[model samples]
Target chain A: MSGTVGLVLVSHSPDLAAGLRELLRQVAGDAVAVTVAGGDDDGGLGTSYELIRDAIAEAGSGAGVIVLPDLGSSVLTAKALLEDHPNPQVRLVDAPFVEGAVAAAVIAATGADLDTVADAAEEAWHARKL
Target chain B: MPESSELTVVLPAHLHARPAGQIVVTAARFTSTVEIVYGAKVANARGVLALLALGATAGETVTVRATGDDAPAAAEAVATALRTTS
Candidate 1:
């Protein structure tokens, strides 16, 4: 099966990822798939990677994943997951949790290409247009 | 997927960086997707920068919408959370 776009949202607070998903649904809806991991009270960095990885794995083949992080270990954790999975198609874009979440949601819903989805996320972050 | 429910909230206080962070946290809770829309502008509910860009202030009405299998529940929860007085 060809790789599909998957959303892996990691945030300092699990609520952040949940919120992003809710927001993304507003525009995008069910066209895309999302897996969320994080928001543990412990605030440990190591756990982030595990959660992201697990989410991606659950998404399975044809679901290329994009990660959205809140802050503090978000980027680090995402990088680590990418290293472990090493899927050329699965990308861990450096997008703010909210921006990336929305972008991914929209792209996935519309069936946009992986690169295009990432670009949309980056634009959303930079646009910062509320 | 278009959401079946939508709600408008006038945040109790200015939605600043910290609150934006809170909003992001809220968005992350559900499987559905959410967005923050203002007049002629929209921001990702999960993106802190985008929410801040909206420049929402105390008492500013912002529309938050959600869609998915759990769209209705998610929308109610978000609206309740956002509308709460800080």
Candidate 2:
């Protein structure tokens, strides 16, 4: 069994989430489980509780799961989903969408623990774009 | 022991998230303190954010330094990873 943690990216645009997943796959390779939950069932630009919940379940590999949300409602939706399911192994990180996903995915691919992976995601805030 | 080497960034994608993440992952494999230096900025090689912040693009040159019991191996690993990233 793999001890590597998984990642879930939540965004208002399905394309944004899918793009991030693809980028992360390139960085972390197939060793890390990356799943995306974006847009509503109708493919509109909005968050859905069901989509987030399903992503959480799919991304978890029995080690742990870290969720990165893009903006306002996506974070709220993930929070609500966690409130309903309440898994201790899951974390919703408040960080930049793209940077955090890449950072977290790399850390997770290294087989770091949940908190370490979340910290790596949060560290993305310190990244300088200059 | 502290060891250092200079390697040119040959990746077409430069030090973007993918290659930078790969460098960070490789650097983390060692017990040494790895640092990548580009121009005036130096980044902790073990952190993807710091690595990406270095802004070392393709065709640019970067210095990789490591310090610890495994500095030699760590430096070699980091330099090789950067040199071979495509």
Candidate 3:
């Protein structure tokens, strides 16, 4: 089994995803296996899923993709993709939009698995006291 | 001539560049020295890395105190800025 955890960022606006990507790059450095799949500005329900699906597939097998969304559509979009994709090993982490994004990228780039990264993200959320 | 005001405002998220940037910008608007007190450490409003090092998360209030001619307004500005999203 491959040990790389692929990451996908899905946000309502591309700016959020782009901002997250920039932050991740600054924190994670250049050696991480992360990809960004930001939604387009057209604003459609199912559009984001396709981008997410494409990103995951492109990342290849044994690569767990973590999706970070801005709001609203991301929850549904991630759910639909996960249900249709049907990868038991592939984790669909519902991390906090901003905090989780940074945490997930930081964890993933450091060579942790998707599950571990997701756990870290969850821990960060609880720490937020939200 | 100025009244000093100090209060704790829990950061709603981890201290990062965006939030730090907002804080620095707000602090620049005032003449008071804004200090964020976490534990025994105190960080200047202008240092982003220092603020992030606090690792302050939501619900964990950090004490903010200002001493200047406009201390009350300064403290209030900091509080309001923290309430706004970056």
Index of the highest-DockQ prediction: 2
Chain B superposition TM-score per model: 0.85, 0.85, 0.86
Q: Model 2 shows how many backbone clashes?
A: 0
lDDT to native, each model? 0.68, 0.86, 0.66
Best by lDDT: 2
Residue-wise C-alpha lDDT for candidate 2, range B30-74, written one tens digit per residue:
988888888899998868878877788788888887888888788
lDDT of 2 at A93: 95
Clash pairs detected, candidate 2 = none
Superposed by TM-score, candidate 1 places the C-alpha of residue A62 at a distance from the truth, in angstroms, of 1.0
* Model 2 stretches astray by more than 4 angstroms: B1-13
Which ten-residue region of model 3 chain A has the weakest summed lDDT?
A121-130
TM-score-based ranking: 2, 3, 1
Error of 1 at B27 (Å): 26
lDDT string, candidate 3, A1-130, tens digits: 4655666777766666767778766655554556656765365332366677776676544757666555677767777888987886656676677666665655555456767767756655553321
DockQ sort, best first: 2, 1, 3
* Inter-residue clash pairs, candidate 3: none
lDDT of 3 by residue, B16-66 (tens): 655654565567668888888878878776444455667766767788888
Tens-digit lDDT track for model 1 on B1-86?
54567889888987665456556556666778887888887876666567768887887898888877677877777777677736
True contacts kept of 2: 0.74
Q: TM-score for every candidate vs. truth?
A: 0.55, 0.91, 0.56
